[model samples]
Target: MAEFWERYAEININDRQRKVLNKLLVADPDDFEGGISNKKHISMTNASSATATRDLKTPVETRMLVQSGGGRKARYGIDWVGITS
Candidate 1:
């Protein structure tokens, strides 16, 4: 976890983004079968859809998360390789 945060030391991850990232870090793989959806992010962060959408972008841009699908099916997963390396 310390190493993971170190990788993003140069990125500015806000409270909501931090919350979601922490959740993802400790979450069971089964809980996120296809990664985290916008709807799930909303539920976890108590953020509006627009806010969730915006918050999710930073990690993707920083290569912390990888996106998949589109629209209602869109999901995001921590880039294990990106961080591990």
Candidate 2:
């Protein structure tokens, strides 16, 4: 958690984005069987599909999250290497 905040300290993250990221940060591996997806983000934040996509994109752009696959198969996992805590 400290690492995450410190890493993104200079970036602007809104409430919904913060909530989703924080959840991902502390979540157990078992909690995300296939990692996080657009559907998962929507469910977690009650945000629209577009909103979820946009929110998820930021972390990926900042290298805080790593993406796998493409399109519907796409999933996101925390960039453990990037966090380095």
TM-scores for every candidate against the unseen true structure = 0.92, 0.90
Model 2: runs farther than 4 Å from truth? 82-84
lDDT of 2 by residue, 2-85 (tens): 987887798887898888778888888799867899999999999999999999888889877789988988899887785665
lDDT of 1 at 18: 93
lDDT of 2 at 45: 91
lDDT of 1 by residue, 1-85 (tens): 6778888789998998998988888888999888999999999988999999999998998888999998888899988884552
Among these predicted structures, which one has the highest TM-score? Answer: 1
| Each model's lDDT | 0.89, 0.85
lDDT of 2: 0.85
Candidate 1 residue pairs in backbone clash: none
Give the worst 10-residue stretch by lDDT in candidate 2.
Answer: 76-85
